[model samples]
Target: MIDYLDLALQYGGFTSLDKVYLARKLAGLTDQQKLDFITPPPSVINAYFAEIYQKQGAEEATDYYLTLSQQLSLFPKEPSFAEEKPFVRLNLSGKAFGFAYVDGTGLAQVFAEQDVEVAENLLFEIAQIFPHYVVFEQAGKVWMKGNDFDETILMAEETEFLLTDVSVSDQFVKISGLNQEEVLQAAEKYDGQRYVAWSGRSAILYIKH
Candidate 1:
């Protein structure tokens, strides 16, 4: 039981004391039962927080809950396709941007540098050539929808940003520095269509269509 708690504490980043208490509580349960409790459902996490809130204070409970949530969210998601193989190198404006590959179902992954404008132009060109191929960009630490490259760049120039996901509807709220709502609004009005988001000052969104 203690060993199971140690494993759970290491795997889930739970506190040693908390895991030990949980392990002791479920001591008579089978190994599978212990495993299930350790890899708790969301409800279990919430319940744990509630218990902590009662024992500790709101601050401690909230902190623990957030930490648990962050750790859980870090669990890797199933990949959309098998490991990608680079089929070709992409060059934009005479500069080496990145590599391109056709994944499962003709979906393409474009691993590229953080040049938003160049990426947008190259993606547009790629789209014209491979209309059926869905293009995605792996830039820095963010996975982006291919079309949002330019919009993300413009947004970054105005304020701090976090590359949360590949969604275009995601807002680039003004966190600090000059609010570039006007600039972003103007860019949004442009004839071309693309989605974009930023991570701090770095552009992370890119798409080919």
Candidate 2:
């Protein structure tokens, strides 16, 4: 048994007396037991924190970071489901695209998967195509290719935006700041017809039957 309370006080940013009391509470071992813990090698203490304290301290750690980010938000508005978990698994065609779960404050679980590297790459690609989509690895699998139609459209509009800008050509209306939503919307209009434009990041919307 490690003198965890003392360790916390000494190394965990707590006040001195607080450290002693906390250490006493955590170790529950007698003074002699605490003495053994206090002088134990650094590796032992580190292991204790990694395996035991880490999980125990997760809530506090999470809250601290969350509060910090919230204060920095330019337009700090709580999510609609702030009180609920932040993510939802994306399912399609009765086949699971991938598992998705949100956090306590409705913030999507950005990196909850197990295969972090692959999940990260997938997330990057999907973000360009759909900003709201998140990816994570779990048990050697990546979940969610991207956000669904509604989330994609909404996020695209929210970020990339859709606007009608001045067109150099007198006969055409230039759609500038076209995000995925605008693209999809314009795409929908030309379902049975063809239209074309000449200037944009990608091809100007050329809709065809």
For each of the candidates, give the backbone clash count.
7, 11
- Poorest 10 consecutive residues by lDDT, candidate 2: 148-157
Please list the residue runs of candidate 1 whose C-alpha ends up more than 4 Å from where it truly belongs after superposition: 1-86, 97-102, 113-119, 134-209
Model 1, 145-201: lDDT tens digits are: 223223443343322233222233234322211223432433442333333433333
For model 2, residues 1-209, the per-residue Cα lDDT tens digits are 44356444454445775655654554557654543334324344335434542565533433433332232221123222231212222223232232222333424333322223443334334333223333334454443322222212221222233353322222222223344346434444333322222232432332222
lDDT agreement with native, every candidate? 0.40, 0.34
True-structure lDDT of candidate 1:
0.40
RMSD of 1: 16.7
Q: What is the C-alpha RMSD of each candidate to the true structure, in Å?
A: 16.7, 16.7
